[model samples]
Target: MTEASKYGITLEKLRSRAAKGDLTQREIRAYFEPDERRGEAFAPAFKLTEFVDKQGKRPSARTVTELYFGAEMGVVSGPRARLRPRSRGRGITTTASAARMKVLAEGDSWFRLPNLSWPVSYPDDLVDVLRQTYEIPGVAMWGAEIGHMVTVQKNNYLVPLRSGLYRHFMFSGGGNDVLASVQTHVKRFGAAGTNPSSAESYLKASFDGALATVIGHYRTLAGHVRSVSNPKPTLYVHGYAHARPLPGGPYIGAKLEALGFDANSSLARKIVAAMVDRFNVKLKAFAAAENAAHPTYKVVYVNLRPAFTSAADWNTDEIHPSDAGAAKAAARMGDNIAANVPVA
Candidate 1:
């Protein structure tokens, strides 16, 4: 029997379970765990965590599963990292011990993705590589939307940006903003009896409005940074790479299935690719506009589409890259920072 038949972890099964209620950790874990009897050597990137409360009481199975998924995925239920407050009238500032930091990073899971421990130790995200050059201190959480980053959590990053210590500001967001509500942006094929000629056409007809909303958030972030930050740190932003339709990318498989498309279909890939392409294009445009408007405090768009080329470079989820993929993106970002922003 196939893995789906034997393991019951098929997309259809997962969709059904997701539709009904929360899926238990046991179910998701068992699905990803290698079958020793089958001699499968794969090691899952996701790890299960304990779900007991501080009172040492175990929650219900459903609650345990909810906590498991939240912890494993680094879901942002609360502040993942916080900036410490310093002396009087100083407000929130880096501690004296951490005052030497040169870069302030803020964004979603990519900035804080945990290291993969599958076959060996490797750099799984940009934070790992960035920490090599500069002490990165800021708020980067899992599943953070750009809108949240700009509005509700503004001070989380804004206060640090005003410190005048950071010369480079690395941001890794906008992916979640677009990916989370793709159903709204992308239309189902054959909708309104429309026979679109190309993926670009389909996207042009529907995704622009959603993309515009995301860009508005970016503008808000840029405006805040420009106004608040003393010495005005140069902003660095990146767009997502061409991703695979894996189950992990914002639950892509189920989302595609819900939209009446096979997760592995060419149309699905094209749809995702089109969205990513437009996002990158708009980012470049945004960077250009910002740079032209404010010559001193510039916005640099780091192109990371070429980072993950092979399947080996991507994790099973296909949203977060593997160690090799992260290294490539880090290299690209490092190169861009070096070439564009001068040293302090």
Candidate 2:
């Protein structure tokens, strides 16, 4: 038996990561250390919420809400969206196998946020399919306050961890984090004929750093799961599809200039769009690598950009999906989940 064996994960799992030079058994185990700082480590108390058991009994859980970006960014205070709970016969939504999955979410605002005026984001699409289509009791959700990745990490958001059973984790982020850093990249690279060195380096460094921190938290969550289940829970992540600027008046480039950047012409839009592609590429690579390294549970990447034809038609803004756009986007993701996820 290996170190991970004691936690319900296998030695082969750790070795696989070590084989790829990602992580070693000792490093993976270190992620689970209880004797550590708050933001620096993964262990934290579970939060209590309005959710109840299958029998309507509330579990004695000391639930926690990881508050970071939402608090400071005012992401939730904007405007309330029209929320309509799906019509349901009174009972817990269950999977076909009758297991309740706990889904924990965080990241940027593209995941059909609260007060966004849209009734449903694509993540909600997952709930609708599971409850109405699959007839599963709706799983409990820990909606990490909306914010950028760094904000989520700074607050130590309670990413889904290993428990007795498998839980579902969804990520609809990276857009905001990537967009925030766009100006730096745009000014540095947009001027050149092909590539901008300074901007590219900044974007590369920022993205890599952000990705590394997030995976550390991810590994920490998996490590938590490892202590409880053999085939741990799966994490679902998506790449924001390419978005183009609106045709009229204020293009994304001009907007960047307003915010103090080098985006003087249409090239800014192209530059930003290019960065979005780079972000998604790195995300896919990261997901594939983690999936290959760990057998406890895998990372599934949903490339959502291809689902849309024109970014202007689908996006309410350059960064967010419109109501009509979200409906279609949600449907595609729901279909993907139904086809790929084998909870039943």
Candidate 3:
């Protein structure tokens, strides 16, 4: 029998409630919070891989690809793509069975982060950490926005959903959308006479629209997933960690500086934090509404913000989490999934 953590209710109890169809969302979330500190060892019993466009140029992580995709990248060369095991004498088999491929994942860089390092290997992303427990196979690009996932990348995820091979779905997106908004939605300076300490000083009147756009795209994706997945698989979506800005960093930091806010200033960090919190709130609301309307095919939002309060949790890039930070967030996600859904 699998053991439950000392902090939260046992997995047996959660499965019992779920089997009887009485498990509430609040109860599942209660189990999510206390499991933030849990970490798993790096022993991959199965292949950890995602699908990439065969026609387009691949993303980074050339050296560490073997850790996830065995010797060769699982290039979708034919009509159907399949995963291979790791080359380093790992336990994963060359081909995965339908029963083993129960989880499907889709989203942006967080889902498909690359090991950009050359001499030194900076592996272990969110998927890498989570796959320590579940074998995730789907589509995730390095810089995918919600819009991209729904349109050009639609077939990549939809085809798998149509196959009815998966029982659980996971997603991570909208962070890139928020970063894109910072470039255009921030003001040159704070509003006249308003306190510099507030987020309103740095944001423009149109910024709220940007947030709405993210919510709308998320809804669209959820709707797409619902239309095809049979027996209504559980959809788990996660908002990003608390990412602070560095002056020299890319995207968020560079865009903030270009908009006239000092990327390293207290006000700037507060503004970023405010935006991130707002995004999470929107996600939480969406999950509630979606679940209320469709009980069996519930949408679960996993908040990763609490695990990343300290600076040490983030990498030098400031956008992505450090190895330790990824482990923390992954533990929360793995715990949430285990609590709500039963996996063989």
Candidate 4:
């Protein structure tokens, strides 16, 4: 029988469990435990916690996973990581100190997707990689539509920005923001938006306008967090690579040439792809500006555009990457993330 048939951990199965409640530690632990006898593969990455710690070592996954359950589930007590949501002026905030420590992953559907088979996407690999590398017991990742994020930190979520807790913050944005607006801007800007640079500028301007409120809210949110954090925090952002003009249905990139956005020939793909690339260009600029302006703390914009370029082999859909593609991305950036993040 297949792993899905044997293990009962299919994508939708996990998603349903996650949606309804926290995954049982026993269940999650079983996922890692060697079961070759039961015809399972051994993953050192999943079970790596027992042996290693990078700089100074941190808590075992056994400890952190205890706290990742549903709100007030109270599966464990006196844990180092905060598990319950408490009173805060605005978005959700976990109690300070006296709680198990954890690293956090935050962003959109791309970050939170729970696919089991044909698993790809950096988030897919990084989830397990994190358990091994950081030695943290748990992580909290959140994501929604761009408008949702801009509206209220993706719906009133300030996250576990506790003082001296949380090791790293990684997320994806601006993709959803630019996706729907692509046709409109291309139509308005006409052929000028076709060039990568021009496409970048147009997309950037649109986000700057559409996302100003979101940006301001994050500033305020970060300010609140910075005040609590001793060294502030470092954040990672990425730009998306371009997708082909194939149909992802009418909602996205289907029939762009017919729509008069693409310039015919490969230029069509290049122009649209360049528009996505613009987000990265803008991300770099945004990070640099923020770092320059701030006396301390930093924001890092990771560039994945080059890696994914002409990488037809790695993509499953026009936009979402295939498993191999996601793995390639995870490999490329894993060390960088490991090196930069604070160890628990």
Candidate 5:
């Protein structure tokens, strides 16, 4: 019987229990232990905690199963490493304390402080990012993509940008909406016949307008990430933008071309550059804030080859990435950030 079938209950049913707070720790353990004769590995139980922690809250059984499968597929890590007390008694150790001590225990192997709190999406991506870019030792060497949701302001209707060193602020297809909203607000208030001398107020209003949109989106994203119990500090964002255009249209278009489309166009290149410029600015701001807020957290930006460059990287549409493409992007991005972030 399949893993799902072996449980005698559907994965969704398990998730429903988790969502409804019906799945207790004992029940969760039993859910993973399919065989009655041989004891099931504790790894599943451990994974449940990791899933809950990484998601910032308890996850549905289905979500846990998907994460497990994804981890097995090298898509990401099933769970963040659990903090355990040293053989020597150092008083009672809570999970949170253990994690902090573990970083310290790992010593140079781990990056300390705010940097440690950065969200990790794909465990394999984390491994790749760390291995290829930064050389933090003692990391379990897993890769995964951070799961995030997008939000906009209720009044201003702004979406957060996704491309940045901080995964929280960068959003996919989210920046465009934010920029448009800001522009609209600027025009609307400008036409109100407010004196140009109120430039400071106007600017503040515009910034507030943008900030409201960003904050609202971030709050929603943060809440969702938290709901998953993801341990990393939630960094809200939208999507990625690029600096250059490939022979096709933009980098995304070039990626499509790589996927087998005739996307070569002048507009594609312009769009790519524009997107890149915007992304860079957003990244810089995010990095600066992170650096200020958490001195130890490292933030870095990487320029990767367009996905369209290789058929292996193309998703169904050629524009988006397949699982492999997402993996590669995670790795490259992680590596870049790791390398650039100053070690605390």
Candidate 6:
């Protein structure tokens, strides 16, 4: 017979002897050790440690019960009630699925999950979708004591749970000074000569300058992560664009309408597309450099949808999301991380 088959018989005999107190825990541990490795190994000593440890050991009754009947003894005793069958739930939420797929596609599994610190304004539909689909666990960082401690100078103050652990990082500002400040980094290149559209050209030039500034900000953040001991992968989730025009300004779509353009104009689409594309390019460069420096650590970019609909959704006049909005965002973010990253 094979060694496994022979070992099965030995295990059966050991259990039989153990049931009658003929075999001590030490002996039980010793039998599992290889013949040449037995006695000298420390498993036997540790087995006895379990009996005296304050943490308490798995019940010895379990072993005795199994030895006598070859079945677990802790089966539920009460009458089992029939659970109502669930309807075929809606397919996983689009945002949740997309976020998960993005992480997996980037091929990084290590994640630093953070908790939401603020309330969001949207209906809880998205929150429910995230919870049901991802089965994410809440981490201790979500508590108010820890979540609000960080001061984000120009950015929204979301809880930074993984700051100590993450090597790669991304940050998203919710349509306020944070996004505006980041945008100021892009390099501005004006049109060659003045024309009727020279004013428009100058605006374009300014935006380019802002883009460069944002890139520098990202580089600085990445360096911070690398400075940590044994830094792991990190990615900052970022907002696409402001949902509103500016301080004391109309809503994004409304602004377009006021300018005699269709609220759903192609120009708006183009602007968003350009913003996304520029962000992706910068992200690729960041990822490439980080991967080269630390082959084991991977960098990634995560994009979140703009959630602003009114002034009430923001925490202050400047741009941070309300607590309710933050919670919804957190749930979406947690679900994404759980689906792609290993826990436990």
Candidate topping TM-score: 3
| Residue pairs in collision within model 3 | none
RMSD vs true structure, all candidates: 12.3, 16.4, 15.5, 13.6, 15.5, 21.4
Would you give me the overall lDDT of model 6?
A: 0.34
| Candidate 6 error regions (>4 Å) | 1-170, 174-203, 230-233, 239-264, 303-336, 339-344
For all predicted structures, in order, the TM-scores are 0.67, 0.53, 0.70, 0.58, 0.33, 0.37
Residue pairs with colliding backbones in model 4 are 79-100, 80-99, 80-100, 81-99, 81-100, 107-143, 149-154
Error of 5 at 176 (Å): 8.6
Model 1 Cα shift for residue 187 (angstroms): 2.7
How well does candidate 4 score on lDDT at residue 236? 64
Residue-level lDDT tens digits of model 5 in 1-344? 64334435444554554444433333354444222232111112123432232334555544554433333322111133222111112232233332421110010001111111112121122222222222222322111112222422211111111211122222222333322232332222333233434323322245445544554543454343333322232332323423222344332444534533233443333333343444445545654555476554333334444532455554333233434654566555554433443467
Off by over 4 Å in 2: 1-104, 115-166, 188-190, 194-231, 246-255, 258-266
Ranking by TM-score: 3, 1, 4, 2, 6, 5
Encode model 2's per-residue lDDT on 50-129: one tens digit a residue: 21111333322221112211211122111211113223223332232244333444444444333211222222333333
- Better model by lDDT, 1 or 4? 1
Each prediction's Cα lDDT score?
Answer: 0.63, 0.43, 0.63, 0.45, 0.33, 0.34
Considering summed lDDT, which 10 consecutive residues are worst modelled in model 5?
Answer: 103-112
In terms of lDDT, model 1 sits at 0.63
**On residues 187-300, what C-alpha lDDT tens digit does candidate 1 reach at each position?**
666552332235555454457777788888999989987885567788899987877775424446567667666667667677777788888999899999999988878899
